[model samples]
Target: MSVSEIEKYGKINNMYKVFLDIDESSESNVKPMLTNIASKWLELPNGFLASNTMDGDEIYIPNLHMINLVIGN
Candidate 1:
């Protein structure tokens, strides 16, 4: 499905906080795509963090190899 459609109809609930997560390696060159995806999924003007860490000490560990998106309403 298109990004816009996915975002518009994606489910959101207490069990999910995000509908999609696109991981681009620290050296990948897909800023445009990432931006497009992020813009489409995150409709609210809020803060977001995209980071990678070897040590798992935060709520999000993008570098630990865990990949999934939480969708909540």
Candidate 2:
């Protein structure tokens, strides 16, 4: 989802989750990669959330791509 789309649904009590589609990345490697992305982007919905591992997928915190935000990725 784009920044404008996030601004609309990203609420104070809620959040959006951005997941990196990287299969080769280890848990340790993902942290830096995600940080790099965040550093380049200044403004966020509710600011940066947290990096998390869900069902084996590494996801960056403070989401940018939410399913409900847009129709498709």
Candidate 3:
């Protein structure tokens, strides 16, 4: 899948991390599918933080190590 396909429903932060709400019908229910796609497009290591919310499933890619280094955090 192309990054544009994912980005169509995702919010990309300035730090290049991606935040996406789960859509099992459109994508896969498995978290790894989305994380792998996000990681490949965003050029980060493959990983994600998932949460179940009242609204839906939320996936957060935290490339914080790179961001922290860049910002001197």
Question: On residues 1-73, what C-alpha lDDT tens digit does candidate 3 reach at each position?
Answer: 2232223324545434434444446454444454532332222244333333313433344433321101111
Pairing residues by index, what is the TM-score of model 2?
0.24
For model 2, residues 1-73, the per-residue Cα lDDT tens digits are 1233323235544654444333443544544545544433222353333223323333343454323211224
Residue 26's lDDT within candidate 1 is 34
Best by lDDT: 2
Give the residue spans of candidate 2 off by over 4 A.
Answer: 1-25, 40-73
lDDT computed for candidate 3: 0.34
Which candidate do you rate higher for TM-score, 1 or 2? Answer: 2
Q: How many backbone clashes does candidate 1 have?
A: 10
TM-score pick, better of 1 and 3: 3
What lDDT score is found at residue 16 in candidate 3? 47
**For candidate 1, what is the lDDT?**
0.32
Highest TM-score, which number?
2
Candidate 2 local lDDT, residue 23: 46
What's the TM-score of each model vs. the native?
A: 0.18, 0.24, 0.20
lDDT for model 2, please: 0.36
Candidate 1 differs from the real structure by a C-alpha RMSD in angstroms, to one decimal, of: 12.8
Residue-pair clashes per candidate: 10, 1, 0
Q: What is the C-alpha RMSD of each candidate to the true structure, in Å?
A: 12.8, 11.9, 13.9
What is candidate 1's lDDT per residue for 47-73, written digit by digit as tens? Answer: 333323324323332232221333232
